[model samples]
Target: MFGIGIPELIVILVIALLIFGPNKLPEIAKSIGKAFADFKKAADDVKSSIEHEITKIEEEGKKTEVDATAPAKGAVEDKEIKK
Candidate 1:
């Protein structure tokens, strides 16, 4: 997948077979697959946590903005009533 074509893959697999032997190859592949899966899961969890924090911060900001303007609006209404 990383730019290695079929021939390259075959050569690499042959080398692995020579070095690691067929008995250990499947176990290694399984371990590698599990590691990648765990990594992906951790990344997704962090992404979701960050998104939740951002959403909470945005909501708090909107609430603060509305609260800040409310007092001014009330002051304006009071002046209009006096006039």
Candidate 2:
């Protein structure tokens, strides 16, 4: 799938069959599949974790912005009351 066409895939598979023989080929393919699955799972987990952290940071930034403005608003109200 990584840019290898059908002919290229066939050649690679033939070479693998010749080198590893039929008996071990399935086992090797199974292990490779599991490795790729594990890698994808890890990548997904990292992506989700980063997204969660970014969302948390954004929420905190919003909260801080609101908090920063609140005191100024209160001061303006106090000045209005004094006047």
Candidate 3:
């Protein structure tokens, strides 16, 4: 799935079988599956955390933009009244 196609996957599986033998293949596969699952969960957690931080930053930026423009908005009206 990670860009390795069917033939590459078959080759890898054959090598794993040769190295670990049939008796140990299931156990190894199970362990690999669990590790992959754990990795995916951790990645998702990190992504969510980063997304939450970005949202917080965006909210703060909007507030800053408003705060920055607020004084200028009033300054224009003050000068118009003087004229």
Candidate 4:
């Protein structure tokens, strides 16, 4: 997948078969698959957590913006009522 063409892949597979034998191939494949799956799962979790924190920070920023305007709005209303 990493830019290795079919010919390259075939050669690598042949080498592996010779080194490890057919009997151990399936076992090795399974372990490699599991490791990649776990790594992907962990990466997704970290990405989601960072997104959640950013959303929380944005919501808090919105709340602060509204709060900041409230005092000025109240002051204007009070002045109009007095007039």
Candidate 5:
């Protein structure tokens, strides 16, 4: 994929084999595959979280604003005594 042809992949694999030795090639390949999979999963999780937050903000915007005259129950009555 990404314009990488079969010959290019073969050359890359051959180089890896030379560097890591045949015995460790499979292990290295497995690790690489796992890393890519984990990266993709993490990216998806971040994307989903961002989308959820955006939806919550949009829903909040859609809600009707509260009327100011409604005295909230817990407000303190601070009537000032004039001297």
Candidate 6:
């Protein structure tokens, strides 16, 4: 993906083969995958936390709007009476 062609993949594999050798390659790949998985999990957690906060704020806003409008509706009649 990300513009990585077959040649690039082959080069990467050769580098890995040289550095880690064949025996430890599986362990190294597993560790790299686990690291990416952990990063995704953390990102998802933060996204959910932010979404929950936005929902809470939206609910509060609706309650406040209803409360504010109720008083205004009642006060409209009171103003007419005073006039």
Highest-scoring model, TM-score: 2
Whole-model alpha-carbon lDDT for candidate 1 = 0.93
Collision pairs in model 6? none
Better of 4 and 6 by TM-score: 4
* Alpha-carbon deviation at 8 in model 2, angstroms: 0.3
List model 6 lDDT by residue over 1-83, tens digit each: 99999999999999999999999999999999999999999999999999999999999999999887775643567667898
Worst 10 residues of 2 by lDDT: 71-80
Off by over 4 Å in 2: 72-83
Candidate 5 lDDT over residue span 1-83, tens digit each:
99999999999999999999999999999999999999999999999999999999887766633435556687756663332
* Candidate 3 lDDT over residue span 1-83, tens digit each: 78999999999999999999999999999999999999999999999999999999999999999898776643666667888
For 1-83, candidate 2 gives per-residue lDDT tens digits of: 89999999999999999999999999999999999999999999999999999999999999999998776643566567787
TM-score of each: 0.81, 0.86, 0.69, 0.85, 0.74, 0.83
Q: How many clashing pairs per prediction, in order?
A: 0, 0, 0, 0, 0, 0
For model 1, state the Cα shift of residue 42 in Å.
0.9
Give candidate 5 regions above 4 Å deviation. 65-83
TM-score of 4: 0.85
**Model 2, residue 34: what's the lDDT?**
100
* Predicted structure 4: clash tally: 0
- Tens-digit lDDT string for candidate 4 (1-83): 89999999999999999999999999999999999999999999999999999999999999999998777643666667888
- lDDT against the true structure, per candidate, is 0.93, 0.94, 0.94, 0.93, 0.87, 0.94
Order the candidates by TM-score, highest first: 2, 4, 6, 1, 5, 3
The residue-level lDDT of candidate 2 at 36 comes to 97
Query: Measured by C-alpha RMSD in angstroms, how accurate is candidate 1?
Result: 2.5
